[model samples]
Target chain A: MPLLKTENVTHFFGGLKAVSDFNLRIEPGELVGLIGPNGAGKTTVFNLVTGAYRATEGRIIFDDQDIVGLPPHQINKMGISRTFQTIRLWNEMTVLDNIKVAQHGHIQYDLKDIFLQLPRYRNQEQAIEAQAMKMLKLFNLADHAQQPARNLPYGQQRRVEIVRALAANPKLLLLDEPAAGMNPQEIEELMVFIQRIRSELGVTIWLIEHQMRLVMNICERITVLDFGETIAEGGPDDIQRNTKVIEAYLGVEDEEIS
Target chain B: MAGRSGNLFSSIFRPVGRIVSPVWTALRRQLAQTPVLAFQLGVLVAVLLEQWQGEAFADLLGFRRIPRFFGIVDIFEPFSDLDFSGILAPFFPSPNNISASPLQDSVQALGELATTFVKAFFYQGPRAPGFFDVTFRVLIYDIVVFVVPILIIAFLLRPLVSELLRRFPKWSLILVHLIILAAIVLLWGDDGGTRELVLIFMGINIILTVSLNLVNGYMGEFSVGHAAFMAVGAYVSSVMTMWAFVDDRVFGAPALDPSWGLPVGFAIALFAGGIAAAIAALLVAFPSFRTRGDYLAIVTLAVNFIVQSAINNMEGIGGARGLNGVPLWSDLSWVLLTTILSVFIIHSLVNSTFGKGIIAIREDEIASELMGVNTKRIKLVTFLVSSFFAGVAGGLFAHVLAYINPGNFGILKSTEVLVMVYLGGMGSISGSIIAAIIFTLLLEALRPLAILKWVVIPLILIVLMLFRPQGLFGFREIELNWGWQKAKEKPEVSGATAED
Candidate 1:
């Protein structure tokens, strides 16, 4: 069984259909990519999966349980975490705190321990800090851990966002646009980092990237979305050669396409 | 027309401002640099003046009594028999009382002191009339009180007081508690009513400000009707005490002995008041789950109106005439203890993971929720706790004033609390405490201003908002010498950069 399976998921914003019959299957330990044009509703699909937007229709099964109408937090607890298209770091909070907050769902201590500031609370907090520091160290961002996330360089902020998602211990990690504002050198580093995340952290990766270099280089399989519909699903080579995906990105061959 | 007036104002005062500006800047810098010293000097002056010539001043201010340097006792009997016709005569006790009254043993005098303390202080104790019969020894003790502290603080302890806040926050908190204790001791004399009242009010204000800070500052919710909760607390606790504990015209007879009300009955009443306020807060908390920001603020305002009107319409209590004949249990010590406990509770809460979740919600509710924070529950709990403390403050306030009415907890009161929160800085506990203290004193200081007080206060707030919009601290805390923060600073790990 797939780690995540969305069977005919549909969402509507008022009368407009944002995502229509969006079926997706992400198997265990697979690096999948969701590719689409600007208005293709790629993010809407991610929102549906993460329960930010509940499906207007159909079932979203994660780990064999249907999580269609659950709140975002509950879905996050079920081990599905995603980064935003634009950065959404708690900007005033320290970088370490941003990562620690993401692990809020799986924290071992209960509300009682937290309020009373029991030894367990402090211990758990220390353990979390140590763990977050470890993740930061792994990403070479340990020196900036005490700094507010917004103070970090853009490339580092994007990386910190990814580290924050990873801190949640997700089985399936969604990257909206990890390579959004990077030069070629940074993009090259990000590509290697993505590979390392898969090989070392062993998270099932699913990403939506406008940068074709990141998409074609790392993603084992690519799914294309166009105008709220899946136009193509294939490996990177097949996707590169697919005329439909090209026309969606580069615009229509004919005026009749409209 | 507005632009012309503005130009005329600047044109008239610009040169005047230039001369005054330098002096004002220097004074501000000095005050800012040595706040502790200034505060100490201010307290010393007030204590000394109240001891020395407090009665004359109190009479002018229309106060029945002025608190003495020693709170309970009016005068020591040491040198009452010695009449000084020359130097130190005014400072020493007059010999006129020596022929009228026989000198008693010092131990017997102390016995009288203990008895009077218990009788007068343990809730509704008889307060003595005003008179100062100063003694030579009393003069020496007063000098020691002034000089020892100045010498210690200015030389040996000034740096320590400032340094203690950062190095030992809990110790600093204890130091503050000790200051309150010392203040109580210094103002323990028979005629020291005005200053003690001011001190108690400051304590109550601190509670009110800190509690509101939880919701308005830390939680980032604009709750304009906080005083409504306080009203509920005030009324409920007042009703509880007046009905069951005290014999009053309204309640007629005590349900239990008046003595029981002092300890057990009064505490339960205060707790009940807090609980009742928390329940009342549901009107806002439930709405808060659905609405936020200005919408939630409107709901709070409505709740405030609802509570005030509800109290106003209740003929059974006292309606708008107000509930009087309340047992005055909130003395300096009581207020001090409760304020510390309230501050400690809030400090612990904000430092918790749950609190971080609350702050995260403040930062970005959507992101916080998506990050697995139960934003709804957090919002609910934050409202309840915030309102609960407001209610507790109301209980204390009602007891202190020995009266309560809907008018006391009106929009004006809520605005007072908001001014405090903003002046201190949002999300700053220390800021609230400092602001509350300053505001309470400012209110008392401006009493002579009458109607001008309200105008001046708003002007101060407007200036504060203009100059420091984020407030003095702005989501940060003062490194106070006090607090019960057990957690030390984050550990420094020396290591190389992460491997590529």
Candidate 2:
């Protein structure tokens, strides 16, 4: 069965149609890529699916449940979680605290338990903290567990965002420009981490990347868009040779790298 | 010689302090490094000793005693005297009717005319009908008569509830709270005597501070116009109570017997006050829908002025003089109980899902909404709930003062509430409670300081804001577990290392 599906989803910003009739489907545990130029509605599609913004038209369904017009948290609770293109980590909190906050939905502790420090509250808090540390260790960030998210380098912050999203234990993960400003070494490491997460956690990933090489390297299948309309969708080799995909990426003409 | 004697004693004690150095060190270190549980017990013991010692000293000094001692010298008696005739005599000069000759009478007449004009424009004359008269009139209403009986019954019912709480092991700690509050109120009672109205005003201030904290602190918003909402409540309750006591178009007929108007009036007034506050909240909610943060604060402040000016323009409600005949509904018992109840309700709300939503909003609005929280609805609900409590406080205030004017609910009043909230800490429930008690006590304690007291208040606030901005307890509550307690045995952690 298709895990996450958007049917004819359209989003408009007055004179411009940011995302129009954009549709995609991913089976359970499949990894997909969305790539386009700077103004292409790749992030807009993510926003629509997450309920950050209402789609101008159409429907978003996840795990057989219609999720259109639902709030982001509700969508999150429905087993779909996401990372921001610009990495919106809770800047003031510790890395562990950031992860802990995302786990607020899963934690069963109430105000009574929190204020009185009831045994249940204490046990749950301990368990969550332990889980958060484990998630950090997976990303080689256990050493920076106590450090604030803002103090970390951009690459590290990006990883923290991914960690927080995973803390929700969602079945589907959406990554918006996860490799926006990474050095090649960091990108290679991120690629490996993504693959490991997919293999071990058995979750589907839909990633939007601006770097062609990284998208070509990691994405099994690519969906290409230009000016709110999908132009092509296929394997990496097909996308590389597809005339429209090349045209969308290289301004109507391929400029050879010297 | 006295200085040397003191030094000699200290010097001798120094060795004693040092000779048992290891033992003292061990004791000091133990105290310094005690677990939270041990520290809590020590604090409880210290608090009890301090309270006992304080009462003993007051008794020795001929101050009013506490815990069933209602002697003539009881600290709060003078505050309940219900008289202010003495203070008004000086500001309001009388007309000189007699003169030696016709020409002299004419000259004196001119001066008298000038005095009359000045008094008319600026001063509230001594003989002019004021709060006392209105209070007396309201008291004659049946509503006024109904209040005391109800209060007595309510007070009687309290011990039963407390007993229930005691039986439940979870609420045993709440008993500690009653003791603490009693200690505070008794300790801070006015010995020098203040006007009954002023005392009532102080009580209302406590109500406003604590109730508003539920919004600004726990829910996380900055409210600048709590005073406006109080005024709205005051007007509503006062008008309704007035109608019940006397014939008015608003109520169609008198709702209570003139003989018992005060009691009846007070009850009606409380209900009206709540409705008025809710209506005002509706006005506030519209602006809040689009504008947030500082904008919301500015909107509330404007609402205060709007209510005040609206009251001023409405001639039927006495214009600026304000609608009178509000029965004196608030006594020490009433004020004390209301304060306690407000604290309890707000504390519980902060701990509930509704309260957690408020906290979540305060923590991060976008995140809260993204988590499926209806941010606008929650804000509105809290705003209205807060207004309801503010109304209850206003009704109590109006009855206690006997008379109120539009000027009573102004920016200055808002500032006072703000000061209490800030002094208590923005989000700390227990902090607000302590701050209210301390703030009231400080105002009384520094009465001799007069204008100098305000300068000191600001300095203290500045220091506190700088050093402890999150407030005394942050968002933590003052839980009174009255009877709900647990087995004293500590749970052993076998494997975990000490956090320190």
Candidate 3:
């Protein structure tokens, strides 16, 4: 059974329908790709699914529970987490702190425990720190644990964002242009990392990617969008051969990128 | 190598300076100490002299009890009783009385000294005979007999207890707190009398500073309407107490009419204050929860003004004329207990997961929420908790002053509380304590400056904010422990785990 599913989901901002009747589904442990041109409502779909914005009209179900009106954090607590396309991080906080913040949901310390600094507070903090460190080490970011999030290089910053989101221990991970600013070599490595996270960590990957090569390389199945509407969806070979996907990519009537 | 230069210089000068250095150094040391010593001595002497001679002058002027300062005494009568022989005696320096009746002279001198003290204080100025005199008397009754002593004890107890807390951890700390509470209750009683009033003000100030720092300093929310919430609490608790006192009796008048009604009133006052402030917080939180940085600040300021104006026009709660006769319930002990309690509560809150949520909100609200923190709930909880404490403080304030005017609960009071928080340090509980103590003292010290006090206050604030905006302690508390030892202990992973 699918872990998270969006059915006929659509979102409108003023006069523009940002995403229209966008339908997607992911079984547990399945790695899927969401590829589209600029302003194609890819992030908008992710946001709508995550309840960052109300869907103009649609239903989003996470683990068979209707998550349409739930708050973002509630959506997260329901086991769905995501990273921003522009790398939204707690800039002033240390890398470890950023990850630890995400771990707040799972903390065992209640208000009483914290206020009194009871044994529970002590145990919870220690446990969370270890977990956060392990998450950091997964991304090879243990060395930069004490450093501020903003101080890291572009690639490492992206890695930190992924690590922070993953620290929440969500079953579903949404990436919004994770390789947006990376060079070709960086993108190639990111492909492997994404696959490892899916296969080894066992998290379902739902990503919106502008880079065609990365999308074509790793995605088992691809959903293509254009002008807020789904123009194509299928295996890599089907998307490569589809005439409609070619027309959506190139402005011309019948054209495609090599 | 660094110390060797100092040693080399000192060794060379040691022999040569030994002969003349002692005398020269003594002279220079005396010269150096002169200005500081002189300034302090001058101020003390002036105050004591003013207290004495002013009464003497009043007596000579044939005034009975020079208004507020001296009691009814005729200073001029003594002078008038002196004969020409006695007048000459002052100049001649009597040899016989100096030795034989020296004891008798000392007794006469003691009477003269008392007369001098009363007279000096009396002639300084004539305050209003009725309301003014009563107010002055009340102020004196509270400050001199109560606030001063508690302040002295707090000054002595703070370091001693902090040292004990550092050494013994929790149990000893609790014992010290119990002792303080016991002492406070013993000295001031729990009644809403004059002693209670002073203690409550001191206590509330402490609470507001520490609790507010959790929001303004630790959570980093700029809240200016603290007094409005306080007013809410004061009105609520006062109304409830008044209701309980009056309604339970015939025709809604106090039945048994216990003198301790003020303390009872204050208990309800805190409850009412907390509830009302928490309710009021919802308005500001919903609209501004999604927005951070400057936007959230603007919303809180607006909420503050809204609450102030609402209270100003609120007829049921007294409106502009303000509520009267709150049945003076607080004393120094009650205030001290609550103050210590407030500090402990805030200290624990800031160190908890809930506190971490608050700090996360301050650090980055969006990031906090996105990480599955119920941001709205957290903000609401924080506001509610903060306002509840403010209400308790307000209840204490109303009963202590035995009156409540809208003007008293105005923005200025809020700013004063805010200053205490800022002066103490934003996230530092210890800083709040230090700031409250210093701020209260500074206020007393600058009282003589009158109208110029505000000008000096702002200037001092500007200087402090410029140099130490994070406050004296920043987010860290004034822990008495040696860091080296705590550091040596296998990193308290439990404490670290709690942060997450």
Q: Going through the candidates in order, what is the number of backbone clashes in each?
A: 21, 36, 36
Chain A TM-scores for all candidates read: 0.95, 0.95, 0.96
Arranged by TM-score with the best first, the candidates are 1, 3, 2
CA error at residue B119 for candidate 3, angstroms: 26
Model 1 Cα shift for residue B481 (angstroms): 5.9
Q: Show where candidate 1 strays beyond 4 Å.
A: A108-115, A252-258, B1-154, B157-192, B480-487, B498-500
Off by over 4 Å in 2: A1-3, A57-80, A90-171, A179-203, A210-218, A240-258, B1-168, B183-203, B213-221, B238-276, B313-319, B351-356, B359-364, B449-500
Candidate 2 CAPRI category:
incorrect
Q: Choose the strongest candidate by TM-score.
A: 1
Query: lDDT rank, highest first?
Result: 1, 3, 2
Give the candidate number with the greatest lDDT. Answer: 1
Provide DockQ values for all models, in the order shown. 0.35, 0.15, 0.23
State residue B242's C-alpha deviation in candidate 2, in Å.
5.7
Candidate 1 residue-wise lDDT, B174-259, digit = tens? 66646755663446422347767877888888999999999888888888988999999999999999999888999899888888
C-alpha RMSD over true interface residues, each candidate:
1.9, 7.3, 6.9
Higher-scoring candidate on TM-score, 2 or 3: 3
Tens digit per residue, CA lDDT, model 3, B310-421: 8789887777887776665566766776777677777777655556677778777766777788888777777777877887788777767766877877778888988998
Model 2 C-alpha lDDT per residue in residues B73-181, reported as the tens digit of each score: 1222222222233233334445663333555555555566555434433333443323333233334321222333333333444456446545555444455556645
